[model samples]
Target: MASPQPVDIPSSILIIGSGVFGLATVYSLCKNPLFKDTRITLVDRQPFPTPDGSSIDSSRIVRADYASPPYARLATLAQTHWRTTFAPSYYHETGLCITASGPEQKYVPSSLANVQALGTDRVEVLTSSDDIRRICGLEGGAPGSGNTGYVNWSSGWADAEGSMRWLRGEVEKLKRVEFVTATVSQLLIDHTTQTVSGARIKNNSSTSTTTLTADLTILAAGAWTPSLLDLRGIATATGQVLVYLPISATEQTALQSHPTLLNLSTGLFMIPPSNRLLKVARHGHGYTNPTTIPHPESPSGDAITVSLPYTHIDNPSQSVPLEGQRSTRTFLEQIHPSLATRPFAKSRICWYTDTRSGDFLISYHPQYKGLFVATGGAGHAFKFLPVIGDSIVECVLGRTPEDFKGKWEWPAERVPEESWEGDGSRGGPVGMVLSEEIAKTTSKL
Candidate 1:
């Protein structure tokens, strides 16, 4: 298939998702002088900053400790934006304490080196577990105690919901940006021309469906991307679990003084208390749902798509996976032993649009002209909330960043499928399907 022709700046753009990527794109376009006359419309299944969207979490770590140089640079740039734009209220510069044990120990030195390569020593390596505790006021012991890591003083976390609200406010200031609450059912495609006109949306408050026409349509729908687009080998939806533990006022204060804790190799991360809630989530193998729908027009007669609203199946109300709960407990107990027995305040399985490779997939669809995609969070794009839109804008203009040359486009071959569970003899991707039986079992737990 030939690459879709580029549209430098479309007169009308219909964005079918209002999460991080969508909002950021709108904000970036509004700022560009070339798009001064562009009429932009953003539609989502729910209201702006929907609670279930990946970007609307309680809090997300905002650090630039990526082992990859491109991401390191992008994260550093985003860190600067977070500080200036959302600071004090939405962004907290509480720092991040990254630790690793066993074979994962290499991440510590490598992360420090990556930061140094940027010609800035924003991190300070701790000598021992005692130093780790003292330097960060964390309950976990030092490197000798089982983990070795450093503190990125310049990095912290952002109040995700607050940041989303702030972004929406900024976008609303633009006369060209329009927000709509509706579920995009399908893309309006011209079969003869092979060009996407816009989207077919179902109004959230009514049963009526409407066709929204535009010169261009960008899908930034996050986990729901695969359901809307046939991105089989390019991206998959993976479910990550997070448990929120409630603490007392005193405990919250003490924990607030600490930085975000992470065990890089284990995909285990800890967010300090926010409103008496401390959260722990895993970034490792996540789960997936094998969903399909009938499509008489398709050659296969069955199309791979998630159930509509996408929230009915995967939402905050859903229970966390059993294994996810177990792993989170084990890691927390290992570090903060005192809080080991504390009852969890709440828990849920958060979904991520994971690419086989960890980089984002942002480009024009090879099969559909005037259609673009900006997804592939891979569970880490939230940190780049500020500048990620610029990357997308560049992609739409046919001038992507040098680092994104091959990384952000569709792969030539079908990439090997990844397991939600680690690559071991244990639970693999095959067993990660979210069936009704599995959901019932986890909910009982």
Candidate 2:
């Protein structure tokens, strides 16, 4: 690790948020030989090596299953990068199984077709229930259960926190990168020039604030991003639940032998933990607006709650809710009866800041110069942290990737009409609607 230097004090770039994205950005920038002269400052609310802060747990699976080719391609590239450069023990290639049931199961076919058209080797359509069972180690299908399958060898889970820790260490070794523990309150703008100049940050402990100047700023604050982008007119919607449960000794053995399973048919997926536990959850359902909900100072120990129109974001540092845990329990009971008797070992409530369009927002604010916004990851952003980090660096350096074109169109419209509703089952009505839209868009290409 290179020591911080006086010359490094004046950074050309500043990144807010220290989770997967921020740390990855620092690593990427520091590795670029062309940018060795550039100084980088990474700011976050939590200090390094702090267990209390929210970092991604590495035991879970990572994958590249998506209805869109761009995402699938990105995931494939990221997996490749992880396998070659990233430590092998940090990631596991358990394979991904996306199973679907019911009338909506047709979406699986459509999604597979879209991915196939992209000509990527990451996805393949499974045609038989027997194949699904054999590949995913699933048994006993319920009557009326419609089964459709998609398998991608490149998709699996990785140790998120472990990856972050490794990358943070690597970045800290760089002579140009600095880690600052401060909560940014606002982005300072030069009104006369109509450009962002720096940031107004409040030290978490002292309550004292300071202004740090930078040539460019990247907002990767996850759920809290919108709050700091007050001048950019950016907003975040959050509602995400992660449930962890202990597996019975027998079931644990079964899961260890089984592949990572994503039962789209049931709208839930399970990952066998490295420690003999199981992690499961539903996707696309628990979105909330962080501004409305109170940010808890610490993790909460409560049951998951499920109120209709569930749309409130909680602080990342807080505890899991009772409703989310219960819902996950019920989901597991229905999907895997063998695990029904086991109690929840732990649960945590997390938030996903979503854009109305169901796509990530990464672009310079239309009205603010030198200020870049990156938020609205929806539910599937974590696995792409490395790629997202690369993109963040590009955006901060005033370069936009071809895939991100038109990302910040003015007068942001309501979420695309094809947006899907939240459901545990894989092929729900909303997913089908989005599938149709995807088909139309892909056909044109």
Clash pairs detected, candidate 1: 129-142, 143-147, 285-420
* lDDT string, candidate 1, 1-445, tens digits: 2275756679899998888899899889888888888899998888766877888888998888777778889999998888785434788888887766554346567667888788766678765667666765656663323356788888889888888888888888776788888898888877678888998999878899998999999999998887677777678777777899988899888888678877665667788779889898876666767677644124345765542223423453666667677778877776787887788988877778877677788888887788888998888888888998888888888887998688888666655465322212111123366565356576786
Report the poorest 10 consecutive residues by lDDT, candidate 2. 304-313
Q: lDDT at 134 for candidate 1?
A: 78
Q: What's model 2's lDDT at 39?
A: 68
Angstrom error of the Cα, residue 67, model 1: value is 1.0
TM-score (C-alpha) between model 1 and the true structure: 0.90
Q: Which tens-of-lDDT digit does each residue in 108-131 have in candidate 2?
A: 665567556656686657666667
Q: List per-prediction Cα lDDT, in the order shown.
A: 0.76, 0.59
| lDDT, residue 229, candidate 1 | 78
